[model samples]
Target chain A: MLKRYLLSPGPTPVPEKVLLDMAMPMIHHRTSEFSNIFKEVREGLKPIFGTRQDVLILAGSGTAAMEAAVVNTLNEGDKVLVVNAGKFGKRWVEIATTYGLDVITIDIEWGRSVKPDQVESKLIAHPEIKAVLVQASETSTTAYHPIEEIGKIVSLRDETLLIVDGITSVGVYETKMDEWGIDILITGSQKAFMLPPGLALIALSEKAWKFTEKSRIPKFYLNLKKERKSQLENTTSWTPAVSLIIGLKSVLEIMNKEGLPNVYKRHALCAEATRKGLMAMGFELLAKDIPSNSATGIVLPEGFDGGKFVKLMREKAGLTFAGGQDHLKGKILRVSHLGYHDFFDTIIALSSLEIGFSQFGLKVELGAGVKVAEEIFKNHLGV
Target chain B: MLKRYLLSPGPTPVPEKVLLDMAMPMIHHRTSEFSNIFKEVREGLKPIFGTRQDVLILAGSGTAAMEAAVVNTLNEGDKVLVVNAGKFGKRWVEIATTYGLDVITIDIEWGRSVKPDQVESKLIAHPEIKAVLVQASETSTTAYHPIEEIGKIVSLRDETLLIVDGITSVGVYETKMDEWGIDILITGSQKAFMLPPGLALIALSEKAWKFTEKSRIPKFYLNLKKERKSQLENTTSWTPAVSLIIGLKSVLEIMNKEGLPNVYKRHALCAEATRKGLMAMGFELLAKDIPSNSATGIVLPEGFDGGKFVKLMREKAGLTFAGGQDHLKGKILRVSHLGYHDFFDTIIALSSLEIGFSQFGLKVELGAGVKVAEEIFKNHLGV
Candidate 1:
């Protein structure tokens, strides 16, 4: 058997403990044992989301929660402003449009964060916009938008709500959902939760709750009001993914034991080390301005196939990095340091990248990248 | 640690092999190895669904697929007929009504199968009906509807589509999608597939495809057309619950090895033994006519509390059985025979029930229920 490492942004490496937790025997969803676990999980998610609001759990991928946010707040033909910077940002616009919302999008260049000025201009021009949707961190392009600035702009209007896609940013970076006036924050269990992708978590502010009450959109299984009612009693509106919930409960305990500040600091140190290592190897970073701290996207050298490079790393080195999507398919490679990662793992990733580049006919110095990464690790760890 | 057995209809006893398979290292969703496994899974599901059509897999519970079926076929204000017999049947009606569809429900008594006459009468009375939805096996009440007869009636109208919820009945009982002329069939991985819940599988016939082309309902994450387009090349429209997919692939391989007929026979034998055991213990069955082979619903004796009986079974005998839902709560106990159960398992379950009844202060003979179950198993196994 080959040793494999997951370096994707969203479905980052899961902790060994989480896997063992999932292997436990399945429990009945209606049992009191499950309700106790569910109650703890709900209370645990509040601080991570940076809010005092109740967070609802759904048994689906991140997109399911994203859809829940849209359907629960917007009615047919309701005006909304979407900031499109990368694949995920554009996905918000697509989903909103699919639900018959009148979407006005502010297009930013791919691999670049959405400018606060641009978002402000869009919202000012469309005063009828009921909501402003943006991604805190776009995983596809590795761009992190300025949520605080967007939140400031949206808070000026009493009727406007700000929705944030925190799927890839929740556990990696700082997200003050309540303090920043973010009305709806959506995330998933796969990315920074260090678990498999079966659970989605969403927290809604009072403003968003009011919008939900007035929204006339048709929904059933993902109905937010009904789900919230059940959550108040520490239950789900429907039969939940019970095994995944157990896994999530275990991961939540681990997160609480390690405190949020230390977890955030560890991810920041790993991200900085990875970036410094790539720079030492003469690789250019994509999203030079306002790059995401969760994942670092590097541009492949001229005439080097990014897809083939990822394949080589996966097959030969057992390191699975993500290739760029759509237009960036053969142009960039994304290396993630989101969850359950450390200094040693960063060193291994740099060594694997060096070998992969060499195999792809790009000249690279052996152990050069690792040396830079180790220095950063030493400085961060003060060892 | 106490040795426990899961007798719930879903989240049933997962095979040890499937659990071990899911514990393997995670794979990148975009890699060729993962795509190869996904392709094999798609091919494997066709025979299980008994359809030449493609089956779309979503990373959600069974209700998500139920929502997908309704949102993709019926437009707002469209007339639809929902045959309600049990909790799941009523759920379909609720889902339809939530989507702004004009739902005409044929409500049947709980624990009884939906009659073909009611379906025909409703259709004849309402020629404007565009779709008819029903459950093949209501897991809540343990009743199996007359799908073959309903299919015959619905096939007469070229415009109206017949949708069947086969979540708990697909692999446990005979469900020949193409042979029965079922326009749409939906199932989940947790039930008879012997895997944990996360993945929902749905297949569509030509009539359902035509309905989708004109459906005006709002959808994005559960959009079947987009899923079908991506699935043509053996890919998902979005990030899938990859670990569950791996577990499902392994479980399907095991099913193929055992053969579908053998799996069905095993479920039938277990169900028969359970029924005999319950009868010998002098307990009345909730589902009087057309009881499902997937599970047996036993009505408690006079002055008996269903919840307390279930708790006694769980704590003392280390057995977990599903209690009644909604109106049936405290009236019946549901014993599931679906998914990876055997004759020995049936015997153990009966013994546990005998212990539970004795603890509840009911007079019952020791080993009598087990003896009856063993005899039934012997007759079925021809030993």
Candidate 2:
């Protein structure tokens, strides 16, 4: 029997405790029992987001929260700046344009992060820009954008809001939303929360909340204003994803037990090990300059077939790694060091890569990658 | 220790087997394993919706699907007809108006169903009416609209679509979407699907699909056209609620094993028994003319505190029931017979109602309601 391993960036392995907690009998959302849990989960989310504001839990994917951030904070025809660095960053452009926002984009090359100067320059050039939409970690390219720096640049403009899609970066690294001057921050449950997909957690600063008052974009389900009012009373404007919220409460308890700082350290060490292992296996890294701690993208060789390699790794080794998307398809393989992942998972991934590469007729020594990953993990102990 | 029971509409009790299935190890969404389950679920949902069309699965609550129906089908400022009978019907009007639809509503009494002649008259008066939005079962008042007659009327109009919110009706009764010529139908997992809230299943007919082609509403998260294309390929446009989808597969399997007709019959029997029990206990039902098979709403006695009564039922009797919303608050109590419920659950509800009523200084016989419910179940056995 081939035991499967889920190593994708999102839909990460769920902890048994969280799963069992969610598996318990369903509770009515309007009851005190549910409200109590909702209250705890909301408060628990603030620390992860590093925000003093209420972290509104939406019953949709990260994209839903992203849309809410756009429509609720900006009016039609309002000028917006988007940093289109990768697939998710491109989504910001798409969402902004869909809402009739005049989108000015800084299109960086794939596998590269946008510089703070570029955003500052765009803001200066377009003084009417109301919001700067960007991703903290572009999942598609595994590139880490300097959100803190960009937030600093955007916060200086009283009319501009810094909206960060921290779907892959929030709990994986230090995402100080308030300290970084981020106006709006968003993340999904399937990412660093170590839960299955569905729920999206978002927090908006006082200035961003003010934007909702004048925002003219028509909305019903993803209405952040209604959500905020209900959530403050320990309820939701709509029926929330009850099971996921229950799971989120348990996950927060787990995070608290592990300590948030240690969780970040663990993810950092795992990402470092995975990177070192890939380099030792004679692979080119995609985001070498500012790689995200959530996942790592590796450039495939000229003749390598990424689809076949990923399929073989799944079918033969029972390892699941995310293949590249769009232009990067058949060119890279992304291995995640996201939530519920450890150093051993990185070892297994590197081992599978080495074996799969050799099977694909590449000159790769067995255990070379695993050996290097083991060393990095060993050195991290500081013994 | 109190043994809790959930009998609220829309977060109805989840079966043990389905919960256990969802508690299994998480799987990556882009994998073949997940695709196979998604494909099966998509097909399974069609039978429940009673449609030959592809039923799109979304990772949000029922309101999200309701919003999708409006945004994907009608453009901004388009005229639409809403049958405002209860809370859910009001939701259709709210959603339609929120998306800039010029809403003309036929207001019905809180617990009364809307007449088909009124809808036909509205359609006849305003041929420009783009759609008729109504609820198959209005949970707030336990009212069921005549969707079949409304569908027949709307089907005759080439330009008008009939959108039915079947959140508490689809799996509880015979909806027959295609047979009734419904343009768009929507339901949530928490209600009759016997799953936790998160996933919303929506299906559209050819006419509604045509409406999407000319629609100009700005949307990103609830984009039906994008979701339809991806769902046809056994995937979702965005990350789905993975664990909930897994549970839905198990739920479909259970429903199929029981047979759809049998499932509908079971819900009908339970609803009938609940109504009889409440009546025998001297409680006046809110919807006496045309009641919903999903839940039953009973008007509270004069000078009785509904909030206190509901709390006592929960804390003292280990039973949870829903109180009315808005103007109906403190005047009604809604007990659900939807999803994963049996005749015994109705009996339990009736028993609690009798005890709670007697304790509240109302002249209620201890076993009056339970005796009636038990008799109904016994007679149904044909012994």
Provide a comma-separated list of chain B TM-scores, one per candidate: 0.98, 0.98
What is candidate 2's lDDT per residue for A299-346, written digit by digit as tens?
Answer: 998978998888878878889899899999989999999888887888
lDDT of 1 at B317: 67
Across residues B22-90, which tens digit of lDDT does each residue of candidate 1 receive? Answer: 877667787888889899999999888889999898889899999999999889899999988889988
Candidate number with greatest lDDT? 2
lDDT of 1 by residue, A1-383 (tens): 77988887867777778787777777777777889999988998888999999999998889989999999998989999988888888899899988889999988888788878988888778889999999998898888899998898898888899999999899887778999999999999888888878888999999999999899888887899999999999999877887778888888888888888988988888888888899899888888678888888999887888888788788877888989988889899998888877778888888988887887788899888999888877867655
Q: Evaluate model 2: give its TM-score.
A: 0.98
Error of 1 at B162 (Å): 1.0
Compute DockQ for each candidate against the true complex: 0.71, 0.91
Q: Is the docking of candidate 1 incorrect, acceptable, medium or high quality?
A: medium
**Where does candidate 1 chain B have its weakest 10-residue lDDT segment?**
B374-383
Candidate 1 runs further than 4 Å off: A381-383, B379-383
TM-scores of chain A, one for each prediction:
0.97, 0.98
